[model samples]
Target: MDGQLPIDTRPWPVRRDAALHDQTMQQTIGVVTKRLANAKVTAYAAYPEANHWRQRAVEVKRQSIRQLEEHLATFTQQVESHGGKVHRATTAADAIQTILEVAQHHQVRSVIKTKSMVTEELELNRALENAGIAVRETDLGEYIIQLAHEKPSHILAPALHKNREQIHALFDQDALVYHTEPPASEDIVALTQYARRRLREEFLAADMGVTGGNFLVAETGTVVLITNEGNADMVTTLPRLLVSVVGVEKIVADWSGLIDVIQQPALSGVGQRLSSYTTLVSGTRGPDQWEGPDEWHVVLLDNGRTQLKDTPFEDVLSCIRCGACLNVCPVFRQVGGHAYGSVYPGPIGIVETPLLTNFEVLPELPSALCTLCHACGEACPMNIDLPGHIVQLRQMKQERHMNAIGVTRSYRWWARFWATPHGYRRSMRWARWGQWWFVRHGRIQSAPGLAGGWFKTRDMPPVASMTFHEWWDRTRGKRQ
Candidate 1:
């Protein structure tokens, strides 16, 4: 439970209690995502050759995952050959224990970490801190959220929910402990500079550094960390021992395959032509090289991913963690990451949670949070049909009798009506009449039964006077 404290603190009860507080989160994510989406539009227009590259990237990822086990073994061997240690963790507990053991053996008192969603999913910081090690997050967004005792609301932008004023307040709070006062005026650049100076000391003093792998190339035995901020580079190179945690699906066959999967989505997701820093560390620094950590370790985590390897959901392995899907998802835009109640949020989490956990206990998970808009599918670099996967999960829930009664009844009623035209027409007429109570000025302010929630935030279109079949009959009956 202590290991899960960070996650439990932000559970459904906590999130619901904090929902109104998340209006700020909603606004912040909306502005950032919309801006990024628009930037993507302009960026794609400039790189007209992106579509060609996207298709190639998809093929490369598909080929890599198809031979994941073999490539992983090859990657392990190459890493070992280069004087790096490899640990295979079949479960989350094993991964955490392995990292903690490494930290303890090194007598690590303080650790610096780069932004890694894999570590977040595993709750690594809490695990390390519980083992009596002080862990500091080096990424600017991650550091802010860490101090605030909050989870990252977005994958890429951990503290996207925080405004400048909130940041200034946080810095001021920390300044009291340091017996120094922050600047009176609130500015992002100043705040960032202060954080950098503080983190620079932590970077030098920390016994170990930890990072999450964006991709693991089998041929070169390299763990790649892509970032716009260069925090990953510092974390990877500065400490005495460097520990990298990588999901099993992150393994690629070779550098060529790694390059393809990372390039397109890295740009599209963040609106960057390329990440400013792409660090590839195969092992520890040689005696000749003064920079880089003295010891390197890679922990490859299965963590339920193996169960999904060959299934219909296998395409999920193609995700590069660019987070474009989160930026484009309408439901994610509304509730933000905390409402989903998982470390991985948005479209990816909808598909991932069911596969990774006890779905029977969480039957409403995939359906309750999705709009079935297929926007995530369009944004996906590997062309993973995310909406189709969500539907598949819903079907699984139905077959297992895990679906909610309301959902089951609704589907049944729609199936029956669509099968019979006369029944459908009569239903539509009844619906129109029933909606009269809520209708005013040709818009429905409220609706009866389950649909009322839908009208709460959106305008419901007025029903048409006649069905399409009836209009077709009236116009072309003689010709028929």
Candidate 2:
């Protein structure tokens, strides 16, 4: 709504601590992530050729990105040829303005939206609501969070952080406004029926339908929507006017390219062979077509995407929002998405957010959000080097002198001590003696200053009485 990514003002520690203390959210996230992760493992185990397909997808995405400008130009030409309009937006503000202008020209009073992470980046729903246009999220998870006034906690399951009881409470409050009876019980069927009854009317009445594209076929000017639910189908077909806001990075060269990566999101995200719906829209309705939007518009948003080209971080653009990495990330599983306090979350977010924002937003994400686990890289179908990127980001942060003076000094002192045998031995002896202050029963329970963070939730055994080097010399013969 404010035409900017919701970069949280709170420090990372504060946000992370809040998430850690929220037992309900933490439990919900853990359960869902484990289920999704297990599903993906089952899916891949059944399909031995998955790795091959994943590699092909990575190559297709890389080629498309290398030729992004050409693809965009061809895509725009084909869309226009098919009676669709394309608007290029260099920034989030530009995209919002273009969408608003389209809505204004069409006299659109209300809009229906499918799940769109890019639009979330643009804060599209809030912008439209501020302009007096009613907007409703039609995706089941999106709808729940929309009513609860919360940002999505997971990429695929927006309300994965919320349990059934919490949803019942939100739905009960919403029912009061509609003057409708609440569900007889907290049954999933009863809840879904109530939502369907409420949203079906909006689907029929909305003047415009907005969606985010999973892939854009440059060869045919087609926008692809893959979802587990049929909401995207309704959003595309029922409204008089249609607007799709997609990142430029989503463009693929042709149908062959689209196929290479089409199944990756579903397979890696929820372990399905395919989603329930795959909606493709090329343009406005033709005279022969009876059930399609009268007008179609595509907004190609750069929003700093082009800047990644020809850089080491270029592969970060290949992300398909599959959320596989989130499921495997230990930190994400424990703390969830909201703790990252960025539009994109999990491993890829730690790399992409700072890169896309030119390091002006969430600069500490690399250091705070990740544990350098390569699990995300293995889970990613796009082969993005998330851990590698995170390391580079930390280096970049240091080069920019973004770390606090005390922290920098501490690291330097530690590094200097570890760099030499004498210093290392002295430091080890000092640590063994100093740790006694916080030791409880044989483990160091806590410490003061920076080291305290590591001991906050977990304890460590005190340094061994003898170093490995000392033990080697005393027991086995010394190498020299």
- Please list the C-alpha lDDT of all candidates, in the order they appear: 0.83, 0.91
Top candidate (TM-score): 2
Local accuracy of candidate 1 as per-residue lDDT tens digits, 1-480: 111212433445466556546777778878988887777778878897888888988898888889999999999999999889999987778889999999999899999999998899789998999999999999999999998998998888888778888888998898887776574568777898889877888888998999998889999899998887898888988888999999988888887777677776567777777888898899888889898888999999887777777888889888777788888999878778777777778898888777776472334558778889999988887788889999999888889888668868887988898789788887888887887888888888888667878888987877877667778889987799
Give the poorly placed runs of model 2, Cα more than 4 Å off: 1-4, 432-449, 457-459, 474-480
- Judged by lDDT against the true structure, how good is candidate 2? 0.91
TM-score (all chains, Cα) for each model:
0.90, 0.95
Question: After TM-score superposition, what is the CA distance of residue 365 in candidate 1 from its true location, in Å?
Answer: 3.2
Cα deviation in Å at residue 68, candidate 2? 0.5
What TM-score does structure 1 among the candidates reach? 0.90
Candidate 2: lDDT of 345? 90
